[model samples]
Target chain A: MTDIQININNKTYPTATQPSIANLKLSLNSNEFICLVGPSGCGKTTLLNIIAGLDNDYDGEILVGQQHTHPKIGYIFQNPRLLPWRTVRENIELVLGEHQSPDVIDALLEVMQLTQAQQVYPERLSLGMSRRVSIIRAFAIDPEVLLMDEPFVSLDAPTARQVRELLVKLWQQRPHTVLFVTHDLREAIALADRLIFLSASPMQAVSEIIVPIARSDRGNELAIESFRQQLLQNHPEIKQLL
Target chain B: MINLKRFLSTLSLLVFLGIWQGVAVYLNSNTLPTPEAVAKVFWLGCVSGQLPFHLGVTLLRLVVSFSVAMLLGCAIGIVLGRNKKLDAFFDNWLVIFLNIPALVTIILCYVWFGLVESAAILAVVINKLPNVIVTIREGTRALDQDLLDMARCYHFGKRKTLIHVIWPQLHPFVMGATRSGLALIWKIILVVELLGRSNGMGYQLHLFFQLFDVASILAYTVAFVAVIQLIELLILKPLDKKALRWRR
Candidate 1:
């Protein structure tokens, strides 16, 4: 993996209309699975959007590596955003572009654990299934950076745990630079190599913690619980949610 | 063997024809000739190639006018759908055009361009264009904004985005517009041909009306209506099903 560092320099917004992440500065490096954890309205999603180049209203220089090549980011949105008119496979292939093979399709479906539902339309799939499709679509492109904003926010508890484990496994396979944004401390602790905790709205990075657990330990509730408890004491807001 | 439902429907149609024949027999005049006599006149017109000639003329006009109008409408619709500023500028014009009486437009075209085939064709195009544009433009408006952003993030080129993203989303809208436009254009073309053109099914139907030949009039109407239904069922329906295959 090539070493890429993103620098957000003095990114500020007007007090009246600004989202959080105003005047926030952070740099992410190669092979970093960084999670941004914060309260709602903390501009976690806004930051992800800006980094993905979907939002350009910020005041900062976003650099990838040493140069300014517009970073190729795979963004898995909060909602699946699958075209209602496309089947599950076709929706995933939309990101893979045309000229994909049947093998690639079967592999992605298998990875996402959606092999049986490839031919099904988006409306027929459950919310969890649709979100899983969206994740695999993002990963299929093998983007330089993966930017996911609360990608599993809508799933039920057991389903969310399954998806969280799937995400960690996929992240391990590729080891691409990841900037995952979510409010769940357990989720952050489970998946992130490094966790960036942010304050309330008009947010700034309050603390940065490196997760010391092995990638294989992601789904172990006891190990994840220990880490969650540590994070809860440091960030009182996270404790309130727990 | 005919199904009972179909036979009953056929019987109703025959009863309606009998009432027409009875009325004509009671009048016993050239202005209200009997159905059998009108049927014979219609048969003679068909065999003598008069009806075919008129049908060919009307079909040629429909093909030329509908093709040009749909092409132009789809182009404008896609453009206006992609660009909000363009949609805002032309939306009012489309609304006014859809609201206008097709006959008034035909008369205006006749006066402006003279009593020519071009004038009649232009009238039919004008009547159909607004519906196509409105339907397609609305489809474009409902486009997935996030998918577009994903395409941008992936550096998908203009051609790729159109083929993969925009075209798939906008297809149903384009088809809906085309069907609605075709349905409107068929009737409007008849009026345009009757008032402005010197030949075509509509002109012949006008001739039959003047001579009070109801069977020939009905015969021409049935033939053209059947053609429209055939085009829709055989051509448009198949195309629609192929394009919407992803729909359950």
Candidate 2:
């Protein structure tokens, strides 16, 4: 099993008045889906950046597997950052380069329901369609680890639900470690195998909840509500966030 | 609709010429020749081949100087925009070059290089380079860092990042530099040619001036302006439309 270890001693910006993250430690097992729940501005994105190796200002060490080499990371930002000049298909193909086959891209376009829009540029796409393209881009890389920073935050309920279900299906097809950051407690409960809750600014993990239910069973509305209620009872502070 | 636009443009040009002809007739001075006289002289020069040869020389100088300035300026501007320390160090130098008058630079180059062709092109480049650098530097500074982060996360190599991520963003700025550079450099080259080298449109204009031939001077001016407009319409406009087709 691939084990990932994260040890963040502290991270602060030169202009900031306080550290963004302090003494934050976590680990992940192979193919485990973890959700990080935190209040807004709790440095969740910062933590993701650190893990993605996008930010090196932090005092931390992220050890992925035994060799400590970084795993191939797929990141989906809140807004789809597709290149405006590139068509939807090209944007996905950009990350895969020559390694991806034509059939794989065709399959992905079909699965994402973007077959008709494959040739369209990003500017012509609707918000939901654009985000799907972004998701397609992230998955096209076949990343060993996926980091999603509130991928469904601003989306309408129906679109968000669609994307969430699509994400689950893709993950099941090819299981990989996923660290999803979202403030939506219900969404966290529904998707994550384990949920890590962080306190406000200068974030540190305050609680961890392991969902005993299987992924398929967790989709039921009753089960998700019961899990949310149980979580609020155990960690009352999380109730305020919800 | 396109035909309407073409018709309106031609009508506007006709009106401008009519007004110019009216004023020239009223003045009845050799200095302000009528449009017809200038056109006649222009046709004669075209037939004699002097006008085309001199225009070619001036066009060559313009192309060479413009390419050199743009290449060097874009490289320097991007580096300055990316590096804060370097930008700070060179900020004063940029200001100094920008403030130096175009005439002063032209005269200084001619004097130092002894009226050579290189000196003439160098003078034009010096006049145009600072403006290109400033425009491109601002574009580089305004680049979206979020997109850059996305590129990095995707593991796009340096080459891909430059071509796909960076170049598209910088293109508008490059176009801005090119248009303004062409406008300014052509004018400076004329002055350089008038002051120094002897084979360009500017040198011919100086000859016309000595002979008090207002018709020949006006003919040269019209011919050069037409050539510049043709280059803009045929080359630059199409490139701009194609490169920025995504904006539509």
**lDDT by residue (tens digit), candidate 2, B162-195:** 8999889999999989888888888888889999
Docking class of 1: medium
Tens digit of lDDT per residue, candidate 2, span A99-207?
5676778877888889999999899998888888888888888887889999998889999898888888878887888999999999998899999999876899888
Model 2's chain A TM-score stands at 0.95
DockQ of each: 0.51, 0.82
TM-score of only chain B in every candidate structure: 0.82, 0.97
lDDT of each: 0.80, 0.89
Q: TM-scores of the models, in the given order?
A: 0.87, 0.97
Best candidate, lDDT: 2
Model 2 chain A: weakest 10-residue lDDT segment is: A97-106
TM-score of chain B of 1: 0.82
